[model samples]
Target chain A: MHVRGLVDGQEFLVKHANGLANGVSELQHLFPAGSNVEDSDALPVIWEKPEEFAAAIDKAVAATQKFVAAAESGDKEAISSAFREVGGSCRGCHDTFRVPQD
Target chain B: MIASGARRLAIAAGLLLQGAAGAADDDLIAQGKYLIHAGGCITCHTEDADDAVPLAGGYALQSPFGTFYAPNITPDKETGIGNWSDEDFLRAFYEGTNPEGDAYFPAFPYTAYSGVRQDELLAMKAYLFSLEPVRKEIPEHDLPAFMSSRLAARAWQLSYFEPARFEPDTTNSSAWNRGAYLVRHLGHCGECHTPRGTLGALLREKELTGNPEGADGESIPNITGDRKDGIGKWSLSDIEYFLDIGMLPDGDFTGGSMSDVIEDNTSHLTPEDRMAIATYLKSLLPAD
Candidate 1:
């Protein structure tokens, strides 16, 4: 499918990106820590660098908000740019905090 | 005084010739700039710092061998390749050697660059020479005892390297040929994507299959045409758009070293070129 498809179907993306905040607030950090989750690619850096992780989560949330605003405005150019930033924010966190996928 | 007709014609001819020459030089330099980007020089040459100057090499490359710092390629006479003559420049790319005729470490990716045409290499050099010279001294590579000397690098080159020019397949489409040239030669995507041999040489037979032990402890994703194993699911436009903006078809952006590559190299490419790359990639065999 085309990137147009991605732009048109922004709900899943918006939800996925914005949900990072929920991860930051409750689900991301555990009280005991160092416990293994089955089938998880969660890297230790996520827990180790809580401050940086929170900041990354915040950036992603902000970018996703901008993306939602851009989508609502119906300006294709603005939407595309905001969508890219949203993607970049996701990447910014994934590259450092998450596990490197195969 | 009115000039004679022949003299006036001569002067006019001279001006025309000079103008033509200047335009040619401009085109050459412009082509060089584009080629340099295609060659993926900036990402490696520029240091990983906020204040890092472009092409004033201090970029640290972490490989299985060691941490290899990219040297200054800026036109600083003593610290850079400013003093390299045209022949020296060509040798660097074509022969994978330095101006002094010493073999360079394969970390430079001259193996792929060896396939670049001589004129294109010169064009890349012309563009580099036009840049503002930065006299930055690069730190030496941190290597183990076995990897210490130029001799070791020379030995590796002797074993695995072959200086060759890219020969186009006449049967292929122009777009395919262009894509091949960019992917295999200038872009050198296979250097990281293609899995390596025990000796650290690229496994040419399995190009774009993705490497498990890539630089900086990352597993490079396979871009072959496999539906399950590779990028067969990605449409040509999706690939092109991803190259342009680093966004995947699923709306996720890559956050790996591929991010820097997209920012510095592929995004700057023409849309046509990116599509051509997609075309070539689409043609690759699926992993078994």
Candidate 2:
């Protein structure tokens, strides 16, 4: 759902402006207390560095909010830039916290 | 006299504009720099050291034949390609032959490079020459006697190598042609992705269908339209995203040599070019 929102461009963003914000905010709550699955691709770095993980989540949330604001404004360029920021935040988190699949 | 002076000023302005245009055209170094990423020269030419000098060339490429050490491509007169003439460089790429006219080992991927345009090759040479030369003499390849012979390379070429330039398909979009040029010539993705014959010749019929064993003996994934084995389900944006940041559709980042490739090559390409690659890949027929 998040991937679609991120890659599907303005139509999806405009349609799911509120839903996108809600979905992104849910990311912060994803790593629960003592929630570690054996087959999960989430790296141990996410758990080992709690503060850093939280910071990454904060970045995502901020970017998502900016995207929502751009969607509301109906400025095409602003929305695109905000969307790119959102993607950048996702990349930043993944680079550090996600295990690479073969 | 006043009219004559004004005419002279106009002529001078015209000359200045022409000079500016020529400068833009002569920026082959910049073009070559971009093409270098397209060629993926750094990944092979540079050693794995964090502070490794670029293109000094000590990377060990392990193949079925043997482990081949990449040579110094820097323009150092004695140790690098500085002494090589333009014709020598072109022939190396075009025929996989050295300046002495001896066949180069297939490990060099000169078979794929053989298809590159002469102008582009010249630009690449220009860019390489522009670099600060690093005088690093790499050791020779650790190969079996049979494989070490230049005759072996010549035999391999006779059987499998066919030198040709990229012929753009007029029926296809310009993007597709660009993609084909990149994949077939510059990127040389087939060198690892495609299955190889006993002689280490790429199986042209099964290009980009994926190799069971690739560089460093890793299993390269099929990138064709095969739903089960290939990237059939990946959207163009998904592929673009993967190239840009090494993120798979399932949210996992890529690992291994591909990870390095993403960092040094694909990540630097323009988004439009990435999309072009994706488009071309998607258009391929599904291969089992």
Candidate 3:
């Protein structure tokens, strides 16, 4: 949900975070199941399907790592595609595990 | 030899006429294929599977009304629309009736389809006929007894529906007009995006602001000009790219039913058409 406020095309707000090797994951935090969390968008499937959820996280981690490298490389074209792929990786998990917002 | 030359010229003329006719058929078929995407036929009609046949039609749509299983639309004689004439196809959309005069349930979204012109419907039919036919029988809808009868659908149509064609707003730009036609009729974005009334009729005043209860019991987001509730911050390119690939203005990609729409419908549209849709969406008044 932290990324919800960060609009696409305008990454200037979080531009300072670019130096981090895993900037994408730096913003992502998955609370443990049964934690005292309220108003969380994470669905029960995240806990129920542990293996699938873990696999999804692995994919996202790799995507974030690639994105970090691309951003640091200073290659505009590569950065754009990597950035989009990172979003795709997040969506792969969100589709099943996140409660859709109205 | 002079007589032979005249015969050869006659043969050449005959071939030219035949080529022109063949080209017309090809053009009609091509346009129809594009319209199929614009009309969102593939997304609903084709079942969700890696090997699903195009337009074989077993996709299910979950609504407050019931779970509607889209029937086979292929040109197969046994289970598809092979026997439907041009008029039969037109009546289905324009009047929301089957070839046998039975009223279809509101799940079909023909209320929005009513605005489509006759020629386009025929072209769409022509395209369907050109495809390889598949014989697939669909399941009956699971509906409550009160709404199960065809009479119920007929009554609903009489009360809440009006068959209307698109009227271009003369004052607006041509692109805007095209966008209006595509969004209002062909694309039928309002079917999911627009909030529905008690009887499942779309609420015109609350158009495109969003729906809490949408397809598959998921909430659909607002795309109006409201900064807080809608996509007011998104530029035209943002909306176009979103439609193209299901990526949200947020660095995250959108998923669920909309992902299917992006893959089957908007992704296939030309950049100009996507931009037109973006322009039209941006022009709507913001509502709370």
Candidate 4:
């Protein structure tokens, strides 16, 4: 799932699949430790701004699910679409909090 | 008198057949010229400066592993591939092994070429043969001593190499198959975008995910739809337009290796071909 140095295509897809699964797990980690649920790092603002953050997360989860399914079925078209969804979620999250690297 | 007439007629027919063969060769050579342009031979072989001759080779390709000298492939009888037979040319491409039986460094991009059609490769040969022979001599590669031995290359090929041809995916549309063939063979895009291992072999598993340090220290971006790290924002039209005119969807013009790529390869391809490439590329799911 580590993105830093991966280059192989098969491994990339496998890693990506794991990462999407992990993203679902990590969604909980976005919140800060020891604070109220509202004060977590992942920002309940996601829930607060239901239209933006919630929609983004929903799309990401859906994409990840589709990605896993398509990849499993060997459907390239569906896999590609799922990958785009995953990208959307990452961009949406970064746009909210992370700086652009390029 | 009848026997004499029959003999004359036979000679005339033989002459006609020879003429037809010559014309066919000429037509094949012309087709090869077109394929060569699409194959991006000029981009790597020709130096950027005015002194360089197209397809004469001698350009230095920089990679994280080491510098690879694109050899003179022009028809120079002594320095180039001019003296190489059709078999030699085919083996070089199909096997990624050099004429000397030494395994070529993957820097040659033969992995992508492994899928090319036989006729297409022959056409490339024909086009290359038709060029005005250039006599410029290129230098040997400056690899580290440990990596310089051809035996090491032989071992590398033994372990990693798998010679194969382009197998059309029967379920896919013809456009998709053509795109796959072009991307995998003629385009050899994976040679740049895919990451290589310590010995300069492509990590086939990581094909086209992206290479941070590829040709010339450029960060070859992940083409997969990783929104944060890849081109997930791009539409199919965006991809096609970029290939067609080297313009990004945002209207910015590219200036580096991609610019040269489009100019030499994708730009010359038909619009339908470009769209197919776009379609195939856009189809890769971004790694999370």
DockQ of each: 0.52, 0.15, 0.31, 0.02
lDDT of 1 by residue, B245-274 (tens): 888877667877988888789988998999
Relative to the real complex, the DockQ score for model 4 comes to 0.02
Question: Which segments of model 4 are wrong by more than 4 Å?
Answer: A1-102, B1-15
lDDT of 3 by residue, A1-102 (tens): 122222443354235325433554543355465752667787878777778778788787787777667655655666667765666676666677788666
| TM-score winner | 1
Interface RMSD of 2: 4.5
Per-candidate TM-score against the hidden true structure = 0.85, 0.74, 0.83, 0.70
Can you write out model 2's per-residue Cα lDDT over B4-112, one digit (the tens) per residue?
Answer: 9999999999999999877765698788888888788988999878799988899999887789999899999888999999999999998999899999988888888
- lDDT per residue, candidate 2, A38-94, as tens digits? 989788888889999999889989987988889877687787567667666776676
Which residue window of length 10 is worst by lDDT in model 2 chain B? B251-260
Deviation from native of the Cα of residue B221 in model 2, angstroms: 0.5
lDDT (Cα, 0-100) at B260 in candidate 3: 71
lDDT of each: 0.83, 0.82, 0.81, 0.73
Q: Compare candidates 3 and 4 on DockQ and give the better one.
A: 3
Leading candidate by DockQ: 1
lDDT-superior candidate, 2 or 3: 2
Off by over 4 Å in 3: A1-39, A46-92, B1-11
Q: What is the TM-score of chain A alone in each candidate?
A: 0.68, 0.83, 0.68, 0.56
Q: What are the clash counts of all predictions, listed in order?
A: 0, 0, 0, 16
